[model samples]
Target: MDRRLPVAVSFMAATIVAVLALPLELQLAVLITTPSAILWMGRTTVQHARAKEDNLRRISEIEQTINEIAGEELLLFQSRHPNRAETVGGRTGMSAVFATTLNSLLMLLVCVALFGGKHGLTAQILYFVFITAIALDLIMGAVQLNRYVYRRPPMILLEK
Candidate 1:
């Protein structure tokens, strides 16, 4: 897991709380800023990945040179890790499912809150329901984050 993920999640939670407390115009500004920040972070991640790939390519070239000088075959990292792609697809699929479920639940909650008002729901009750939904979402997010941050690699054993 990336070290920055936790910090980003915390930042998002803070932004949501701040938005909830701010005026309507300020909340709109903050909402805009949040996506901009996310885009900047994503661009940074892409640049970092590209730089790492370039460094790996250079290392591979040097390895090829050394192999040519010594008249021996040297295996590249990719050949040694041929199974890397196989392990990632399952996790990605599961994550997609999880995200979709969470989003559906949020939509259901919003619909309930909106429709309840038509049936003479009190303002406090609507507010409570909305806040409950947000709280549930945040708690679930924190739990998922904790699982990812503390997850151990497969076959890693701890001593008692």
Candidate 2:
């Protein structure tokens, strides 16, 4: 099981509780900030992915040079580190999907809050559901950011 899944789920739960418990102004702040943060994180993730790819390419080139000089298949970088050599799919699409879903949900809730006046049980329930959705999005964005920012480089790269 991917460890990040559990961490993301727990983070979502905590965010839901925290946001729901916050004052109206703070909740609004969160709603305002989340989209911007998602956009920034998406950009950062792309840049990080590009950098990682470039670094891997450089490592492969260096290994090839070393092998040529030694006149044999000495540094089998890919064979030795298959996991690191494997390419991961881009995450920009996922980020866009999450952002779009969160925005639509937020807009729906805003409409309800603005036009559907009179806070009854149903309205309250809708509000809760929307808040939960927003919290989930926030946690997912955090998870994505964490995945790129904190990943450990391949051990071979660290060997100088």
Candidate 3:
């Protein structure tokens, strides 16, 4: 409803550019960047909305009962205790950052690809590479999200 219309328009505009433009390279450039721009917009819209919702919920609940409290002194005492914060995966605030940053990079590559597509075969190959990378990044995110929700096992993060 709210999300789908913009996405559709983005792709359609890209298609129009491809058909209307006479030069193959410029057309290819439009083809490359158009959908990425559209998808980037869509993903950004949804994630930011969700993050705002979560933030609002946390703010509103901060002053509430906080799960059957006895007294103010008890609450104050418990707040000083050590709480172990375990970040299980790279799925927190970083996901959006990773997505956005990569897209920005790819968007540049997409422009580079247009020049390559027009001038040499290498550029076309590079264009595909950029698109493939974007797709793979998204797929990996889905897999990670699934693993997080299921809690299948103790997944280890191997740091280099």
* TM-score of candidate 2 against the unseen true structure: 0.44
User: Each model's TM-score, in the order given?
Assistant: 0.46, 0.44, 0.42
How far out, in Å, is residue 42 in model 1?
A: 1.3
> For model 1, how does the per-residue alpha-carbon lDDT over 43-110 read when each residue is reduced to its tens digit?
34333433443444455566777778888867556423453233222233334334433433443344
Residue by residue across 14-133, what tens digits does model 2's lDDT show? 544465566776765554454344344434444555565456556767788888899999999643565554442224333443444454345435433442333567755765666565
Q: Judged by lDDT relative to the true structure, which candidate is superior, 2 or 3? A: 2
Model 2: weakest 10-residue lDDT segment is 1-10
Pick by TM-score: 1 or 2, better one: 1
Which candidate has the highest lDDT of all? 2
Q: On residues 8-40, what C-alpha lDDT tens digit does candidate 3 reach at each position?
A: 555554554354454875666666666576456
| Alpha-carbon RMSD, candidate 2 | 10.0
1 or 3, greater by TM-score: 1
| Candidate 3 error regions (>4 Å) | 1-20, 49-120, 141-160
Name the candidate that leads on TM-score. Answer: 1
Give the candidates in order of TM-score, highest first: 1, 2, 3
Provide the RMSD of all predictions against the true structure, rounded to 1 decimal.
14.5, 10.0, 11.6
